[model samples]
Target: MSLRLHRIQRFVLSVLLFSSLVCVSCKSSEKITREVDPTVEAYSIDEDKAIDRLSEAIQHKTVSLEDTTEIVYDQYDDFIAFLEKRYPHLHQKVEKQRIGKYSVLYKWEGNESNLKPAMLIGHYDVVPVSSGSDTLWTYSPYKGAVDEGFVWGRGTLDDKSGIMSIMEAGEYLAEQNFNPDRTIYVALHHDEEVGGVRGAQRIAEHLQDKGVELAYLVDEGLPIAEEIIENVEVPLAMIGIASKGSVNIELAYNQDGGHSSMPPRSSVIGTLSNAVNRIERKPMKASYRGLIVETFDPLIPYMTYTQRLAFNNTWLFRRIIKNKLSNNPATNAALRTTAAKTIFEAGFKENVLPVEGRVIINFRIHPNDTVEDVVEYVRDRIRNDRINIQVLDRARNSSPVSSTKAMPYKMLKRTIEESFGEVLVSPSLFIAASDARHFHDLTSNIYRFRPIRARHEDRSRIHGIDERISTENYIEMIRFQIRLIENGAAEL
Candidate 1:
């Protein structure tokens, strides 16, 4: 009987020991995860000062255009002087260079050799403000006033924010006396709103000539948004990994001129219009099997169980995913290449039948696709040999995929993760063009990320009236930029 009791006691002791071990293991894991700095605390940004600076920037009215006939009120010179005044500390420390009449470049020399440098790019130029719409604005377009959490004006969101953030960070680093290992270049182009012939492209050419192969280039593209992820509303910081290539094709057809009463079987206007209709009907197929879809896979773990299951079932999810993306204009843009018909010309006068008519198409090509493929696809769709297709301009596809593995991207993600707290960081393809294209050959990895939270109303103001960024987001943006430069510089 005593022996039997000993056996029972030994078995109970064994079970208790196993249970204790399991509890300890789980506690250790939970503790380690809690220690990891996934979410950065939110700090109050200096909203008033940020708005004042943004407002002052908008007041300059630096309209970029191809017409070299300068506007009498053109304020490029004044803008340069403003930068010199605002960032006096930066001016004293960093090496600054002025390219042409307006473009600016700054270098913070590092300890390493000058083989590969990481470049942070932004432009100061803004599109001309549309006239005769004073009442459309809640505040004057140039007023830069902070009302209801936003700093309103032109260039507030487009790019001046990028320039401000970089300078703010540089100034802070100088104060901290922090030095990076690799050389860093801050290139600001003067003509991004217009084509970048004299501004960014020329800058890239000069850098290439100087044998400066860039480690990576960071530019402007996507923004951070709160409470919206796959319709679930999580904070998301979208970094643009690549921009689609652009091609302009002009289609023209000729018909013999004649009196309006006596017309040919098919007029030039009719044929041109028919070609456009056909091209539109047979739109480019949207495909999601690429780097873009892959980037979002990491976020699946953070989603709800239903969402996780939906994400996991690739076979069941493909059709639903495509449909969901097609439903939203913004999501559609991020997933596919887009074709827009910008200009069309047909008749010289109403009374006469024109001899020639032309239509121009602008295509934003996806990274997996090429300009040749786009043109060929359009040519095949139109199928009318009488229509002449001529290429106007083509900005060739960039080489790098803007890897998340790169030091700058990792630093950006880490900084954002700390600052925004709960936001998920993901990369996508940016539809519009930016100055980053010029640095494709020089920089191996390039991305576009502005760390600010924006909404539908904020996005509408981007080339429209009362364009503004949140005063709070603006200050945090500056802090994030300072952190990125400081963090990225350390690895160099």
Candidate 2:
């Protein structure tokens, strides 16, 4: 009886100690957010002038069509010319060059040459409005109309606001003669909606050829998302430390053609469907470890008490945490490599089976997984010798994850803190590819962030009808840009 009591006491003590440890660990590492930056004055913009400039800027239909030849370069030229006229200070103050014909690169030489340059990149080319969706727009997609306290049009949020705000900030700085201690480069790409092959890629190559390494590169990516997570309503200023890689895999299963009535025991269509189902039902293993730690750590204190417990002691509650996170597509995408069956082609008609059946599966490779690993997963999932799998030519692995501890990141973070006060800032996985990916070879300190407040419903507006940005949000974007430029100045 004495021995049993001792054992029971030891067990109870162990549970108490563990619980204490977890409770202590659940405490926040840093304050949920710093007090609003009282020292730095908000960079003011002439609201009417800024809005008019953006409105006119959006009127140019510089759409990046899937077909390269279908893209109108004349419009791109006009857009470039418009910038030259509207922001004459930017053009006159910086050394400007045209990269890849329409894409423009500007170099604002700093007083200090020893420091590495900082770059701001964004695309002016917007995605084409889906056919027949134009009528859904209260204002025309290309009209760039300012009405009802919103800038209603395509590209208003996707990126034109980002580009215009950047230029406007730089122009304002130049007008005020605020010379910095580091060189600043801003590149506006002509094509980013498709793949950035002809625009951002060329600009990256141009910088590489010049042997120019950057302190950091900022491009249009994750934003200040509101209510991205359930029950967490605080806006998250997510800086994308890395973007997921993308690959399109074409799976072909072909057999002898036959009549629909007398199909073989295993037809090509059946085999292909099975392959698709296998990939879908069993996806790549989900992981909550690694970079995701920094992604959510800052937001921990803002989460519910139970939520904090699950995230705080991931070792004991990892499975429960993963289960909770996996329920949402956005959170799940951050947790693992996603496989989507984008295209499927089988029979030509109902009467007969086609000889060839092709299914295209697009995988957004996670930072933990490589392109090679993704291809292997596809092969293993299918496991059918008869099926032919080919990774498309454009398939590439994920970008190198940038350091959260690096000075450039610290600078970016400081900028966000000082500019958008009291906002919860955190690093996150950018599930979609951005123009920043093109500059991976240039530096490992690349950060993809678009300084705009967004919500779950506002996501589709980027490439959908009736896209718009609130008037106040547009003005705030310019202020963020101004602070980013000042904060990134050379201090080393």
Candidate 3:
């Protein structure tokens, strides 16, 4: 009986040891965030004057229309003139050139000519309010009303705020005689809303032709997400290290037309519907590993106990985590390539069966996948010799992931800490496309971050109606830009 009791004790001890080990592993995670002293001093600006500048800029109807013929070129010109009138110091300090149709590039020469330059990118163009949606806004969409402690308008958030902030910072720096060891280039695209084909692309080519390789480039993108992730209430400063590639695949089916009474079993509409259904049903595989792991590592420390355990012990809970993440549209997009069927057209009349049906599927390619991979994905999924598949124009491969260890990334991280004080910083995959995609070959250290403090509901306001930026957030953006410019143009 004593021996039996001894055996029970041994078994109990073993079970306890195993449980303790499991607990330890569940809490283990490599914290990659390094606490560092800020490199730039806190700078103050005239808040009212700064807000006025952005508000006035937003008042301009520099809307980007799909058909360039529909655009009012005068508004674009007025915007350029407004910059000259407002930022006299910047105009005097830098050499400005017009590229593409309306894009502007400013070159601020540095003391050290040998050092590679840093580029600050932004787009002045804003998306147009949908027809009959104007009444939905509390303030006029184009009025640039400074009410409710926010700059109420179309461009305030989706990026006149970015343009105005950079210009404000650059003008202030130039006025302060803050000469840098490296050159600074400010490239503002006019048509980023449509695709930046004319604006950013032209500037990139012009820079490439001049053999202008940059040390780094910063553009507008992911922001300081406040309460975006559940259970992690702390704000996350997510820098877009890379943007997903975008391609619109057109799938068309052509067949003989027939009357509605004698519908064929395999009509063009049915064939096209089947193809789209198949593509929608089988989305590209979700990738919870690699960069995504790196993206969420910094936030793991801020998660609740259960959340932390699940994230930390992904080996045992990967499927559970994946299911949870996949359930949400936003998180799901981050983990995988997304195929959205944006346009589907079949019969034009009620009684006539359409001879042709066309479906356009726009896929945002994952960082791991390529444009070719997506095309092959669609082709294989459709598996129909009769259907025609063609890739539309403006198709681009995903930007190569920039290194988090790079000096530019680190400097930007330091700048964020200096500007926002306490915040979680991480490099994330930008699910949406941005003007930064145009500069992939120009620099390896391209980071897309706008530094705007955003909540979950604030997202729809970007291109949607009632777009606005809080007065406080706008001021912080200016300060952030100032620090970013000074830090970026400083010595390595």
lDDT of each: 0.74, 0.85, 0.86
- Segments in model 2 whose C-alpha atoms lie over 4 Å from true places: 1-41
lDDT of 1 at 265: 88
Q: Of 2 and 3, which scores higher on lDDT?
A: 3
Cα displacement (Å) at residue 454, model 3: 1.2
lDDT of 3 by residue, 1-492 (tens): 867755764565465457656665543343435443344334658889999988899899999999999999999999999999999998999999999869999999999988999999999999999999999999999889998899999999888999899999988888998887899999989999998989999999999999999999999988888766675677788988988888999999899998999988889888999998898788888878987788788788776555676688776567667878888777788898899999999999999999998999999988778889998988899999899999999788788889999999999988998887657888999988888888878889999897899888988898998899999988888888888887888887
Q: Which is the leading candidate under lDDT?
A: 3
The TM-score ranking, best first, is 2, 3, 1
**Which sequence of candidate numbers ranks them by lDDT, best first?**
3, 2, 1
1-492 per-residue lDDT for model 2 (tens digits): 867755764565476557656775543344345664664454657989999999998899998888988878889889999999999887778999997888899999999989999999998999888899898889989888999999988789988999999999999888988888999999999888888888889989988999999988998888898877666777788889988988999999989997788878888889999999999888898998988777888777777555676677776667667777888788899999998889999887888888999999999999888889998999999999899999987888888888889998888888888877768888888988888988988888999898889887887787887889998888878888888888887674
Global local distance difference test of model 2: 0.85
Q: Looking at model 2, which ten-residue stretch has the lowest summed lDDT?
A: 24-33
The global Cα lDDT (0 to 1) of model 1 is: 0.74
Against the true structure, what is each candidate's TM-score?
Answer: 0.85, 0.91, 0.90
- Tens-digit lDDT track for model 1 on 1-492? 867755764565465446656653322111112221422223234556556767788788887766768653258888888888877777787888887668898998887775466788999888867778767888987676778887777788888888987887787667667676777899888889887878888888888899888877788888875534453455567888877778888999997998888887899989999999998877677776776577566566655444455457655456556666666667666666667899999888888999998999987777767878887888899999999999886556534577777777777778777666667778777778888888877866888887768765566777888788877777777877776776666663
Candidate 3: global Cα-lDDT?
Answer: 0.86
Error of 2 at 200 (Å): 2.2
Winning model by TM-score: 2
lDDT of 2 at 60: 94
Q: How many backbone clashes does candidate 1 have?
A: 4
